[model samples]
Target: MKVIQSFIVLVFGLTVLVTNAQNKIKIEYKPEHPLKEKIEGQSSLNFDFIIENQSKDSLKLTRLEVSLFDKQNKLIQQKFLDNNGTAPSINTIPNIQWNSVSTNLLFNPFPDVNSMTDKLEYTFTFNDSIEIKKVVIPGDYEQATDFILPLKNKILVYDGHDFYSHHRRFDYEFTPIKQLGFTGNFMRYAYDFVVLNPEGKRYLNNGKNDTDWFGFGTDVLAVADGEITAIEMNQKDDKTFDIPSLKDKPLALYGNYIVIKHGENIYSMYGHLKNQSAAGLKVGDKVKKGQKIALIGASGSSFFPHLHFEVRNSINHQAEGLPSYFKNYNLILGSAKKEGTTHTITTGDIIQSK
Candidate 1:
């Protein structure tokens, strides 16, 4: 995580007063860890920058440009920040306050290197008046590791059915955890599987009782064979609309969850289970794939009964989310029915276990 920063004062006009005004605007950048090294193709890097205005008048930012260089100092690519169709224009900045902006840059065809030890340069234009350039941000890039699907022969309820699923709907990008911080897995690629009846409804009859939910008390099976690394079984199931706040109990975010280490730096997490359903299991216990581990429930921070499933790189939620494919599942996308192994399911797709 080595970082190199530089402060440059660029003066385009001959007027001393204008030079002093340009100096009042300061720009600082913070690059994510992997960007410091060489990044692999199809991977993305994030950049965080702090823009400050020190002058008496407001500062308006109009455009930004980023340049990437190879190890030989050759210009690889140049990119302009695009905010939809129009160039990104920052609101007038009040004096003496810092404004933070971040960008996620994707490298399509990354340079051929084991590790990137090059530099990324940035140029910012303020109100079309002057250009501020900063160079020599140190970082490298590496190839991204591809993850395999860990689950087999398990039915993710909404796979072949449709109902109101929340952040865990796989393709639903507006997840609460993704909004928390810049780093960590934070349920970004997690999926929530809620039971739905044949009528495409989540509950039956009046829905007064928890049993009225279609998938309530259904067996939550192990996605892959692995030793149990962590388990939390004491949390109580919440009544509809009575889900507890995570502020009161932090771990309640994944009430009665289980973590299974499937491989080195790879783990599977099953969250929001029925109370005491996993009481028989202990850490270090070996479980087989498709084995029943717990029952789906509306525990922790859930609004209804569902299974929260995710493939993460680490045992904790702070790790990066890994993409996974399922083995032997039937995917029904409207009128089409595709059945096979290595199936990737997204939001609103009806999936059934083969």
Candidate 2:
């Protein structure tokens, strides 16, 4: 395995100061390195957009337009928004508050991925004046680290990083968690895995007990060779599928999880494990690529037994997510199975290590 040097970049919109006293606008985006993902066989780019009001005054965005350009500055994609026609219009950003939107760009003749760029233009009316601002968003793809399946069985990717997956759609705008030094969609490319029975369902009869799920208690392995930097094995596993209140408890989202540092600022997190499963493990412990580190369980915010896995830039929860590519795996969907080497896996994939 190759060690990826720390190169995570955070992109923010240009701050434009208005005539109003202490009024400014801020824009933020995730998956800082926008990679071209193959959606439905067409090359696509997905992103999350956020607009923040950094002052004590309200800001009403009257018009908004987003455009994508290639290396040659040729327009490849564009999005338009207005106060009317667009459903659920909420262009007004309250003082010190923020608004977010998620968009995807699909192109038949995909632009050169190396130098593609995005531009955001907005018209705002504030302090009795109409101001127009345009910010050029520039970024490139981040190098993906080669990883292996964390679980040792033919598993189902119940929910992986897709356009609509909670992992990709979650916007960490909560002030409490942000104030606690935790922010960012660290699980942007995360995976939730479960094992299916012969009937193509997640569990067997009744499905009430964690024991009924095939994935429960299964050993979770290290995705790569690294030193364990953090461990949380005390959080009790949920007995049922009811979602727990994770308010103000940032760490609870990953109950009984483990963090392993693979390289400079490169870490892999395995979350929602059975309590005490990693009882003998502690920080600073060295683990191999296939070493068993914990057991899959319904813990924290999880509604059922599953393994939540992700590769991130930092060991902490406030870091940016890094894309993951697996080696020697078979992605099976229905009767069609595709063998992959160094390939990106998506939702609904029945994966088996080759």
Candidate 3:
């Protein structure tokens, strides 16, 4: 079935180019490499479809409609591409200029088909005339298993300063990844933790250096017992209070990161650590939960010292992000401390490890 699906997509790709040569717009679907195994009614699939404007005039993308059809050409479902009612239109607000490209996410929900004959049909309005395109998508959809939190007895602070905290919703969180010319892993559940003193301040005194920040140089412990499958430790920490450019130096986005494979298809990623902190560690090293692996640092697209952590289904960045919770921690809210093991930490919640 997988082979048949690949062949269909390849044939569709070759034919799509010729079909759109006379039209002023073109569409193409980009799926993740090494596609995950598919499971019926449990797996969700995602991909990116790009719309290129070959016309000379600027055009407003008023509406984008997508439909899913079974092998018998029966319509299964349909959706409008407008940010789930948050936005007015799809990608372009006013207009998409000539020769420009707009990438949109194609997210399919559960109860997915099990055969390779399923198809996706797109109907979009550009300016006045409506355009249409069709493509054959892989029907194999595998759902990710739930992940357990690995950290214990650790006090983490969230002040709403972290990028992940600010954009926890799918509508806002997934936009950045699309703008970066990438798909999958919207990072809606990613977290960044900082430390605060008793006075609830993130820094000591002037906070001009890394040592002055409460979280700087603090031990970054492994969240779970797992093998170190990947590591990137060469990136240097950004100067204290110096803003790093994510655009100019995109490769340094997650400076000095490590990936731990905790279980089948479950990996925890620790990003933006101090330079050379994990120098002694290498791929295939087994690390126990709570073991000190690195130190927090202001590195890789960071403005200050914090720990960027997330659990993903796959090692690659394109994999879907899974929600993570701490096994044991005391939630601190304005002088109140509540001990809980299954608590899902949120913005402005200060946590103390038990």
Query: Which candidate has the highest TM-score of all?
Result: 2
Best by lDDT: 2
From the highest TM-score down, the ranking of the candidates is 2, 1, 3
Per-candidate local distance difference test:
0.56, 0.65, 0.60
Candidate 1 ranges beyond 4 A from true positions: 1-183, 206-208, 239-250, 340-343
Counting clashing residue pairs in each candidate, in order, gives 17, 0, 6
Model 3 earns a TM-score of 0.57
Give candidate 2 regions above 4 Å deviation: 1-24, 28-48, 54-62, 83-138, 142-144, 239-250
The TM-scores of all predictions, comma-separated, are: 0.59, 0.73, 0.57
For model 2, residues 1-354, the per-residue Cα lDDT tens digits are 123322222111122234432235555455455556433334344555455565555555554545666666677766554456655233332231223222121111122222335433333333334354544454434444557899878798889877667787665655554555656777877899897765567888888888989889998988888999888887777732222334344445777789999998788989889999995999999998888998998777788899998877875556777667777778766777777646457888888777
In Å, residue 106's CA in model 2 sits off its true spot by 20
lDDT tens digits by residue: candidate 3, 22-141: 376666654443132332223333343445666554545556666777778888777665533555545433233333444333332222333443666666665534456556455443
Of 1 and 3, the candidate ranking higher by lDDT:
3
Our model 3 lands, by Cα RMSD against the true structure, at 10.7
